[model samples]
Target: MTNEAFQQLLQGGVVLLDGATGTNLQQAGMPIGVCPEQWILENRDVMIDLQRRFVEAGSQILYAPTFTGNRLKLAEYGLDDQLGAINQGLVAISKEAAQGKALVAGDMTMTGQQLYPMGELTFDGLVDVYREQAQALYDAGVDLFIVETMMSLQETRACVLAIKEVCDLPIMATLTFEKDGRTLYGTPPEAAVVVLQNLGVDAVGLNCSTGPADMVETVRKMYEYATIPLIAKPNAGLPELDGDKTVYKTTPEEFAQDGRLLIEAGAHIVGGCCGTTPDHIRALHEAVCRLTPKAPHASHHRVLASERQVVEIKLDGSFQVIGERINPTGKKKLQAELRAGKLDMVRAMAREQERNGASILDVNMGTNGIDEKEMMLKAIYEVTGVSGLPLSIDTSSPDIMEAALRIYPGRALVNSISCETEKRKKLLPVVKKYGAMFIALPVSDNGIPKTLEEKHAVLDELLADAYDHGFSPEDVVVDALVATVGAAPTSALDCMATFSHCKQDLGLATVCGLSNISFGLPDRIYVNATFLGMAIASGLTMAIANPSQDLLMNTAAAANMLMNKEGSDLAYIHRMQYFDKKEAERKRQEEAELLASHGTAGAVETAGESQDAEQGPVNPVYQAVLEGEKAAVVALAQQELAHCMAG
Candidate 1:
């Protein structure tokens, strides 16, 4: 295919590419530490056979034996002077091998050493190498240039820019990262996407460093940052040293399954690298072809943010249960309002929390001196009107609960009904009749269970009542009631145990009033943030906390990615861009203030001094005010206003 045609291919359905070159050549007795490109010319029969196998395996594009044909790499084996001859021979041999079938790409690998800031190799030097290599490969009429196994963004950008400068071929670049999901230089997937996408690569993705499962995650992350097509060329799982030879344990069928996942994760191209065989590629080809192509418009419309999962309008997926920030039980303002029988504090809390990332604001009108039922209704109207993010109505009063549930829009979470006899009989029935999801606290009439087993029993009773109340397992969030850590040092552990039991045993998602765990403690923010992370790690699906606190909000944002809810660094980048704009505005105001105070006087001095002595003494201060320094202008305007008023 021509370079333009290949670009078109990327925009359509899945295109299969060739598998491992080194492994195939090694099995054919190509010598190690020798030039694989040179061996392709010498052992033309094996090279031809390899190309034919890839074609048979359904590779629409086959790479020429040019992985190490660059000047710097080829010079290692004293073949630097043979760049044109070696590349020309690869084209000549691979064309004959293909017998006019598969499209050939000029393959380029890393320089195997170091680059600037870490090594001696300069950006210009690296580009010179790739430029020369690309020029030779393009002149020989290769279909595209594949820059493979790159780890450094700097080096990769240099290579891609250099190649594009010399040749107009389509470029597919892949960076190799360690199993930790980061490059050797610690470049994360999100950073890689921004760097490569901005650098103008035709396609950007991961290859050669990880297995299928891990690669699936990598590809998913790449999709978040990738505007271009993605390529997945994972090894058949990680390779192992079987005696003297490295062996890939995963079978072709198993490998194909991983390839299928990469396809689902939005990979437009699929192939095997290093340890894959034609058998692997053939299975992948069949596996990929059997699957119906995803709709172009459908995939494009799908929204992904930094690892935060959307709480859709459905009752099945995890809902963004915003912890109600409207309770006045802890706050003095709300406490005084509660005594005065006012519910306006609840309204303010709800609006503030919703704006700061609360999808479902938790509303609690349970303070002394208040008619709980009367207060709940007033708060609901005030909150739902300001923000359309759903509400979590919290109260034990059946009358109060019924009133709030009547007005709540979308799917509302009732927080909560305990395992207490009266709660099960009264509140549970209300939740069932209203078609609202309920929070089942692992607490009995005597209060929250102290031990995990007791909490488990409470949850069991709550679940039984919930099902009897006509709620499914998914419709309830078992609030593993976070007890204050300072009240009893073991409260944190007990809370964690409750979370685990609800998730692991009952198979129910859990939520917690995260702030309670850190209450009455120093650095409560730290405790709250730490507990939220640990609670999430223990399988807490939802949380109730102030999302406005950077510590708290950041923990949740981090949890989204860690839990694989949000796609990847895509969300993180978004947060930064938003925060950066905010920061820039603040800086501009500060600069303007500083300039108005000090800078305006300096400008006035320079302007006044420019005039001749023939002119009467000029008022620099008046000139400063006239120059539109708002701070100075305001000072003068205020003085004039005072004189006019005095007169």
Candidate 2:
């Protein structure tokens, strides 16, 4: 069986893997001073017997005994002359142990060196060592490459890239980190995950340096940023030598329990590394078999503190909500302010919408006869300073659009462009160059299309043109044009139908100025709210609306809940509790004012009252006596108690 086949076996369920070949070899009569790879070749029977025991112990994936067989390390043993002969012999020994029942992964480990700028190792030289080793393993027909115990991202990335150049086999890489969850060079777990994921490593994880308990936390962090499958191969525990023999203190049961916890944390594949034995892998297999992994839910895109937020534009769906609060659209005050180049107002508006749940903010600088470019620049800078929420730069001027994107951090959604060649040629390049997102309107030089077919035709051309300009299908959002329902009877459905078509055919996301659907209509809020529900069901990713409006904000929250898009309901539930409290308080105040106007003017009283009234007043004759002694106070007390009793 090939190593790839073993990975396939791992995918089907838990697959046992042998561990600690070097340590095992040291214990099995191999001299400690000699290279383990050379010693294993010299005593093939010892290596074969080790693998046989592991296979009998339930290991399905047996790694060849060639941990330091790379040319660079072999030279230290003065055996650089026999690199191929040694590797071939090691593979032969592993294959014989496999007996056609197990898979053999050719082992590669860190060179016990560092790479610059962290250390003296050169990138090219590191790549050369990995490339040389990878070829030797590939030619020997080993199952896969396990580049384990990697400590530096630079070196790891180089080795992985070099291995890919020489072989098409799947690579499983693991980096060793310190107890603080950082590589020796300070690479955080999440950063390492993102870097490795983006590099398209098949399975990435932690190994060698950490034990099972520490590996669980690190694996959780890795799973957060990783899109690919994950692997966790932690050490049994840090070893301490006892009379020339190193010993890992963790029992097989303890290590197995930790392995199961790592699997729960989203490691699809699990095994043991340094100081681990065949018994540990066997127990791990049993542990994994008894456990059920938690399936990860779909993730919402978020802008993290360290990375600028990104808003993906989906233009071809039903209706997109392009948040309008950022633009000086309806407010003459805001328009005048923008024209005057006062950007603090813009920043405040952006922050408000972002806090109120704006997915994408729409920015427009299209004021009467002003330099749109300059206004756009100031607006972009000012808003981005306060809120890193992705923007939809709303402008028709190419120059203004280009300039806004230059300063805006992260990927942004361009307001729009038609299918016209001139607009596409000018705008698409700018989007491509800045890695900006965009929206495409279904209109050509002739203007906005009147029918669904015309709309589809324009959308197709726009998408095709966008792709020609290096835009991926994911980067382009299609706006099917939300025409005013009040203006034309066919407008609303046409927009929705176009949205549906784009989502299904073009596979692009859609956006619309939802308010435009009810423009000039009486009771616009009702129409806007109803239209929004329809649009969301139609696959709209975002919108440009006043999130401050209760209806819009409530609708988005409710929609997220119903659609199961929001991860948790704690925030919404808490907000509802606050609302319930406010409503109760308002009712209480109104009831108090009613009672005070009709009855005696006194402090509000609860249903249970008169507990502190004078005990003597409990007697009717005493009450009558107090009525005359403290007439006003007694009268007020009587009124309150009477009201409470009546109620």
Candidate 3:
């Protein structure tokens, strides 16, 4: 069926799907330990009869028993040579069973071969395997595609990408979550929803891990972030070992009762998995047919995700810091390490930044004397392994960006796209295709805009192009174009104005490089910290900055609290507690050193050193802000806002 028709079908009510192909076939005298696809094809009459019973029992969608038809899986049974015939025959059987009364979904799943960094199966190789099976299913004319019982989100992504490359069939994907609400691979249900929905899957959810009652919570977690329909094809219940066979104990009535809970929790589509039969599907249909389907989320959240974590970007939420130390631009140590083809430093930096409270990490590998694309892929693989923070793909090369996004196993944030005709033209489609949020730089082919109006014009042009490529305001974060305050005394003011404009006038999130305004200034940390506070007060959503700087980080936490952003009070208190502990440890080490020296002279010298430290020049305003002296900080914030408005 076409995507339009599929959507219309979902609008009618809960889309009922067929249940338990393999188990039901086993009950029909297809023996265990045999190839399911081969057995189904050999016993075509029985396959048709079972599916016909489902169609009669009110299954709106029937999955063709081609789940194991991929090249790798067929090779397991020495039926590799007959992959096409086996898949086509199964589809034909399912179609016959449907009798044009229900839709037939060409089902696919994992190849039982683990993907790379874990096993020998290359991602491209796996895609090719699925591509081969998808071709035969398309030729045989299945209505839509359903990839179910998946345990790996990346594997699901490979199948969806392969099928889209082959044909534009409506695709639905569901992963099986363990009892702890994560997949076997540690991917949580919400992360699965974010990753799959962004990859253009028409519907996404969990299947087969447990019964409907247990699956309801997972469905609810996904519903908060899902902008597409959710599918809940749960097993009949937890499996039980009965002699030599595994059985589910849930009766059709019990299964139906829990199926209603799935609907109430936001499952737009419902079905059964292992241990379910036509009776379960009929009971589910009877229980939920009249219940109003919960609509998908009204708008897509501005979110970035890794395999296990999601970082949401909200316009009025707590300020976020994108760790910027991963780039090798000015870091001699990092650049040297990258040239030697090592990611030890990259991994270390990822961990350090996460500890320093960075919401996202920016990874840029544009140094010389290395294959940038290769290093980028390696960095992505290494960093994701070490940290759960989502990456911001920062590269000037479109080729490197595409390669990273293709293999990087999460929703990334592109560092930038500009209005420089060729750059936007080449990269916009890649970003959209890979489902990445991007930093939209308001730079045209003419270069940085000289005036706020020119910057606005550049942004307008770029956003128009982005909209043409199907990006919404939530998918973009505008860069406020921070110029050096040393060069232009009003550059900071211009940036603050741009931040306000992006957030208030254009309805987009804004970010800036926090250190740009501090270039050529003495005590750069002071400048950076102060500008950060002003920027936050002016509506900046996030900043790319060095997260290890205590002054900058503490200023951010304090600023967030002063602004009364959501959850900032507890965040500020926790941040301060951590710092306090670190401070106490430092003093303990100092006392130990003093004791080791062991004299009144040593104590006098240490006291003098402390006195000297306290006598150093300080920025009282910035210090008061960091210390949470709310009266002074609030007054300064008000003054800064008044100045910003007056300017």
Candidate 4:
């Protein structure tokens, strides 16, 4: 009836949840391929009896049989319109069967479609699907919600986001894993822990992939990172084909033996999936009823995450440089291109930033004439499709932030929010709700903090606001309010002090708009590059700077080497050398083609190395990249560009 009630069952020790509703229902004379929800509605006694048996067998939490009632899942049977009635009816039957004895959880499951980038289901579309079911389930008087058998972590994230929009019921979610110990899309156990636990799911773990033996290993691995309670619902071992019927090999006793191991492995709740039965639950309950729950592992949450990777934020670690060159802020050419809806340049910039080792890309499409929200979303669409890199969404508008947040398929970092009460009150909730990281600029009503103490004061307030709104401290990436050196002679010193304060004093991840240090300074790249190294050595973990700046990039490479980033020096060498080799091969081909077309520059190579006595003069651009001579390449590229423009 209450979370307190549900939690009470867990506190007593391992809480036993009911076994497979689909498997039990099929065993009870339902026709193959018939709609389970409709059939259960018509035969309420059969549904009630099945659940009552689970309760009798010692299940403390009963999942209502609404797994396939979501609109998308039901649409396959042409019963999408019946979604509301089906979900409500199933919950009602579940509650009636529980009869105030066991906690009834409103069950949800995966739709057969994939999420965007993986499949066609848009994030908003997924939200709508889960929202409708959540509303109906809440109205039907369920105690909690369980999203089980999920295959994709993105879709599970959308479901949790949607359900949170309509209800605050404790959400216990689980993803089905493959034999390789990751989701088919490569979501590892740690990524799942990072995403779901941060979203505040009451419980999470594996389901439907393997039997007790495999699930125990997954649970043990999950325990290494999760601070929240973990659930385990394994199949009764793998199923096999026997004649025309499928059969699960693990006996009830063997399944129960595995359940005991799952409880010992730190799972708070143990249930069955796929081929489990009431007898299986009974045996599992008997086996684990006496075992005490183990204390959960400590949580580590300072990370910049995408759907596929979680980059930890650590000062001694490799710096996280979010490429800032994608913004159209002062880039007139890029702005003009965006205005014309030509995103070819945007895609090219994304590729370039990634190649330059930018860990995250900062996308800012805000300009005067065009709709910033529309352009921002459009640019995000193009960039995300082509780049695997995570995004740092730069926007000040609440509407745009929420719109982009909904459509963005992975966890993203918001460009900024400050200590201004109105903006904080408006946007922090959105950031919290979507589980996004945002740069908390140290700016109070006094304006951007000019002194280190003033910056600290603002950061303190921002942290309070974020915490009050349910954001973890790790989600607040500190910007430290970097100021231009020319604007204030002491600005560079003040900025470095605050940046250090953020990591050392606040124990938080730090980022900066590093270009600010070079603003109005002569030979800006030199100042920016030097300050970047200083910032990292002083505990700045991330920098928002132009990745295309060769000096800045070369400086970062050396900084990585100094910080002991694994293989950093060797990687830099290979990258430089590979470019040179490719350039040489390209030069050879270009010269051969030119000789065939316009006859050479009338020069011949050394006698032994001369190319077919008829070859044209060598193209130097090929030689530049081939030789890995960066200065030569830049000169050749500029020369080529000047010639093309003039001709």
Q: Pick by lDDT: which candidate is best?
A: 3
Give me candidate 3's TM-score against the actual structure. Answer: 0.91
Q: For residues 1-647, could you state the per-residue lDDT of candidate 1 as single tens digits?
A: 45579867765578888888898889989878877888778899998888798899898888888887888888888999999999888987777766667778888878876864346785567778888888888888887878888876556766777786786678888988887887776666655664455345677788897776778888777786566788888887888999999988889999988788888877787788988999999999999976643322212211111111223322122324465568776688887876786655565566557556676777787777777776776666555544545567887678888766544433467788878888678887666544466778777887867677787887887788778755666567777777787888887787777767766776677777778887777888998888877877676767777766766776766766676664436665565575566566567566556766876866555444543343567554575443323335567767768888999
User: Where is model 2 poorest over a 10-residue stretch in terms of lDDT?
Assistant: 300-309
Q: All candidates' TM-scores?
A: 0.48, 0.52, 0.91, 0.85
Report the lDDT tens digits of candidate 4 across residue range 473-549: 66778886777888788877877787777777877888888888877778988888888888877888888987767
**Cα lDDT computed for each candidate against the true fold:** 0.71, 0.71, 0.90, 0.81
Which candidate model has the greater lDDT, 2 or 4? 4
List where candidate 1 sits over 4 angstroms from the true fold: 1-3, 292-647
Better of 1 and 4 by TM-score: 4
Q: Candidate 3 — what's its lDDT?
A: 0.90
The CA root-mean-square deviation of candidate 3, after full C-alpha superposition on the true structure, stands at: 11.4
Better of 1 and 3 by TM-score: 3
Candidate 3's C-alpha runs over 4 A off are 585-647
